[model samples]
Target: MDLSCSDQSDHPSRRRALAVATGLAAGALLPPAAATPSAAAPATGPAGAAAASYTNPVIWQDFADLDVIRVGDTYYASASTMHYSPGAPVLRSYDLVNWEIAGHSVPVLDFGAKYDLNGARGYVRGIWASSLAYRPSNRTFYWLGQIDFARTYIYTATAVEGPWNRLTTLSTPYYDAGLLVDTDDTLYVAYGNTTIHVAQLSPDGRTQVRTQQVFTTPSSVGTLEGSRFYKINGQYYIFLTRPANGQYILKSSSGPFGPYTMRQVLLDLPGPIPGGGVPHQGGLVRTQNGAWYYLAFVDAYPGGRVPALAPVSWTSDGWPVVQLVNGAWGTSYPSPAVPPPPRQVTPMTGVDTFDGTTLSPRWEWNHNPDNTKWSAGNGLTLRTATVTDDLYGARNTLTHRIQGPTSTATVQLDHSAMRDGDRAGLALLRDSSAWIGLKRDGGVTRVVMVSGLTMDGNWNTTGTGTDLASAPVSGSRIWLRANADIRPGGPRPGRFSYSTDGITFTRLGPDFSLGNDWRFFMGYRFALFNHATRALGGAVRVTRFELSTP
Candidate 1:
């Protein structure tokens, strides 16, 4: 796997350079002709009006490690969720630009006891990188993910939004694997980090029949991973990313397991934000109109890696090139010619009423949640458990991704059911976490603000916590909100605030700096947690969660 550069020692210098470059590019490329339109604007075309156009980052929220496939006129994308379960999120789009969460490949990542919050931890372990493919032979969808130390798992579903079956797990680890089902119905897997390998899978796509060394990236290529295998026009192409050189494509006319030739398809593309890295680790897809486009992600920290869309053109020699504006990555492009359907294009971020029987698809558990410890009736009820003192160990910590530029998340919590030693509140969860919530102590409930920072090596859990602020609360029901300003500036700080009436909010604690801890390998997320520091049998009822951005 290509580990993120969030915590690297040279991150400061690299980030400064990236920021300058990105600003210049955006100023130069983005104009009236290439406008970055609002996502709320309807993407519609009258009977024969111009196709609706959209800006880059088709999906604004953190939809990282992207792999996209177009079947007929519909487009489906699958991304890496790391340890966040309901892991492998699959998003569907009528227009390649607008997408909504169709479903997830698995409801819970139940690979081992660690994933279930037993003895060990799966913080940076579960579901590293994933590949999603649709096989025309059986009309089945296949999803593959690397479980780090464990085997590579294969999941299949008849429908994209599944009822997926975990068909089998292979003993051999296919690091950052890419699945390709050929025209002849032969299954192939291409994977590796420094050294790339190709193998033939069984007809059932379960076992590896044969393996061969295809190509190894030169030592000069800093880190090469995230492989997307394709057979276009009878030629085999494998898309891989090198941190220093951006994304490259390996071409082979010989076979799937090839002595391939490589070319840099996307090179030195400007990062989406200032202080961000280049965009990479995504696949390509074609529209019904015979146009091609590449979908990739930029390493935007404190908000996770977000996806970017770019138009693609094939040269006369049969190589695909990402279109660049002003000699850099383009931020806005014309929408595909395909007419978008009448369906509404929903943003990934929205309010969760907690009125439904099941959690919204927008919400994901910190790990595989303890199902028995949670329920949804009139609201979301989370029973306190004796996990570790840290929020990392506490299960049933429901989280949603924080949006970019600026966003705010507010949740109304009913702590009346909470017992002594019960702490229930809203948290900004990442490798480092902070929360403002109600803590019941000595028969008194107080509004307390706590912040935890993880040291360099101790990313699996919170290193230490400090009490930032506290105040006495007379009522059991309280509202907690986090305002995040992640736009290009100095440090991206999240302001924590509390409210009793839900209309007026009072700020709590100092500005909380959102750190990009490499262990979590994700952006800061809004988390709802209820845990017991002393004893169990405590509970919190969350009635509403509202998210807003501007």
Candidate 2:
């Protein structure tokens, strides 16, 4: 809805941060300890909008598993897209509440052939809970994530909107890792599941030096991950999430490798939104002014996991706590500072004309694509990349993050090029999906609405959707629309509509209720796809996509 100074004497981490930027004293691996915890400045902010107070789930779309940082006055956040191509989405904001799609740290999820959807595998896999870091000495941004739980992939770029290059892949996986560039310009990765491990990396941060278990979960904490490492108040801290359990912090006064003590800071949230589930597993950031904040995710099902920002206050004991309002997570908080109106980039929701040489960074393929099969020159031309029974096996199915509460996706489609046995449409997707579009059979074309489609336990679409409704339609140009009420509870309604002249519309089919199944982690999406039920070479063009909210 809406949207700091440094104190070196206030917190040693501030001095260590400067050292991390300029390089610290070579010999000291750690900052000196104080009898009391180091201090940090209190927060100062306004919301992302003109309201002067920011709303929770700030960028209310599925920007999940975030790791955020501040570079100068701007904040950069990298998030997981799971099996989506361009795996890690990088979001930028002058004011944290009003974020923009900066670019992607990962150009493609090429960790394996399966990621290409070559074998109908890689669903609910690929990138997860990535760690994003910035090294001031080299002025580069780093993205690291465990892929398939087999290897950790690292990427580097000079800018947030990258021409990102894969630096290297470490054979050792760092699960839910937190990438930290320390005082001496040293790199360390704090990661793991229940048993946490801190790994030291090479000077450039590409290679692993060594890894050792730093902390083990207690019996009270069943499982723990999403480790975000920080040096604050001269203490090495690892902030962790026990998912539905609560948020916890591990403080090590000794050093990065520690004899550490743990504490559960908050639990059982009356989340930012009603029925928005729990907000968990995110990273923390310190504004240029030295104020601290935590950006976490709310499993707002049907809409997916959306980001929620909350302020952090340091306890006199040096611990950072998520400030609560009325004994619950507040719905609105003071936003970080920003320059006046008119942002340089487009906001998250808007109209996209498919006239660019490449698709906008906001669009991502369902998986690693067959790049040869698609182009964006004169509207999106998706030449059937896969000939399959269902959309799940279809490659190059383009998608955009669907918005929250309620939203509509409208697209102008040119379907004249569709050949026999071709299906081209607009869809609301997740484990269970639905769509409305054109299906060509023989020499006849029909406007069709399909629903009750679902994927198997292993993510394979057993078959195409049931035909809920169909009408004979003429002409090549048609407008397809989908409306969703993704407000985190029952009757998460998803519906389809169509128009012949882009004015008068007819609702189609029964409402396809968006499901809240936890097995399929990622939430509903707005999708554009064309696939062959028989053979390939058939294509369709999408002239424009307008994403709107009401």
Candidate 3:
């Protein structure tokens, strides 16, 4: 591989001007473009679009905690799903700017009965960081993810979009793991946070044969994790993220288990951005034209951490440097050298009609859903299960990511079949969540807006909201909507409203300021929830769920 370096000077005033022009705050690297909520519309095209240039946070939506790999010009990205069923979402991209959900590594995370909605739960616990690798020798795709802090499993498939096979589950849990297939076809896994380790896998890639400590970061580094191991040009490289110090790269010419040399490739340089956090925990890929670029994420909430693309230039001494403009990461750079295919970029946020035989790829259950209690036929039907009053603990709460800067989501619910003590509606899901929906109490149907806090430390709602808004309703059908204004450098807040006509919406609850709680470690998502407060036999059907951003 040929690596070249070029030096370009940047001016501070010009950098600030560029940030303002791109709708990003002076210190914030990439902020969501201010949008006006409207009806669901067609996706315009690829984000960061220009005739010759594109912007950072290439992916405007939330596909956080990502790892990307390239095989023959096509790039595949895998992201953390964390308790969401059909976990470990894999996406495919051509230009590294536009992406679409290709598939998921697992159909359902049934590591134990808890993931299956049993007595126990896996909230904030399912699949974390995963490594997606391809082995050319036998033409197989492999995915490794840690579960329950005790098990790490390897899944394999002959194709990227697959009917994957669970090859084996390793007894040792490797946190934030990275998988590498060396030039000799030997397999290695690098993992851990404070002290990183490299371990060789058995010939079958099932168990660990031998392990050794390769490198350790200082306490000053501050939460180093997400190790990505790669072998290029006979040299071994490991990429690690230190949110306080930026991203670090370790290189070893000796071997995979290395006495490596470490360098801070990208630093949290001084900048004027609003939400200032380092770019870290991503993968690197050499483009079709031999140009290298790093795919990483920045801590931008309440939209959650979003991906960013930056150019990489290698020095004559074989060290890679993450390029910056005027002491900060560039907001816009030239597009990659390869030409993207003739396809319209699909919007990750949109409407789901529930008319199809299966659920849309955009939807994911809070956990492994009880399939017997849910179906997509005339409309999306969710049967109430025995659970607490909180939406977090309730099973079959279908969810979708909240779009950035500004957006609105609306859902039409048919509660004709709802039983007494049944609650169903639209919600903004997080550690602290709020909803506006229909509730049946004392044989009376009413429209209510409620908020709850996860006080037990397990995401189970303790009790009903302190401020409850309720009004009697005469019908079995209702419309609920949530408007989220999550622009950076401002209060990230959301509001809930209800409508009987679906045209005019009445605000029901106070504006809820979204929280960036570290426990969930995810963006606030819009969810459709139906749960039983007393007994089971309650159900709701959703006819239309529309998401729009201006």
Q: For every model shown, what is its TM-score relative to the native structure?
A: 0.90, 0.91, 0.88
Show model 3 residue runs off by greater than 4 Å: 1-50, 218-223, 270-273, 456-460
Off by over 4 Å in 1: 1-52, 455-462, 517-519
List the candidate numbers ranked by TM-score, top first.
2, 1, 3
Task: Write down the lDDT that model 3 would get.
Answer: 0.70
- Backbone clash numbers for all candidates listed: 1, 11, 7
Better of 1 and 3 by lDDT: 1
- Per residue, candidate 3 scores C-alpha lDDT tens digits across 1-550 of 1110000001121111111000000000111111211111122235433446667777755665677766665677777777788887777877777787877888789798888666767776676777887776787878887786688888888876677889999888777778887766788888776688888899899889998998887766654566778766566777776543366778899998898988887765532225634556677766655566777766666766667777777775567777787777788766776654556556677777798788866788888888889889678989997556766667888988877768999998898899888888888887777888888988899888887654455555565554468878878778899988765557877888888888898989788888754445567888898999999998889999999998
Task: Write one digit per residue (lDDT tens) for candidate 1, span 75-95.
Answer: 787777767899888888877
Cα RMSD of predicted structure 3: 9.1
lDDT of 2: 0.76
**Model 3 weakest 10-residue run by lDDT:** 19-28
Pairs with steric clashes in candidate 1: 19-275
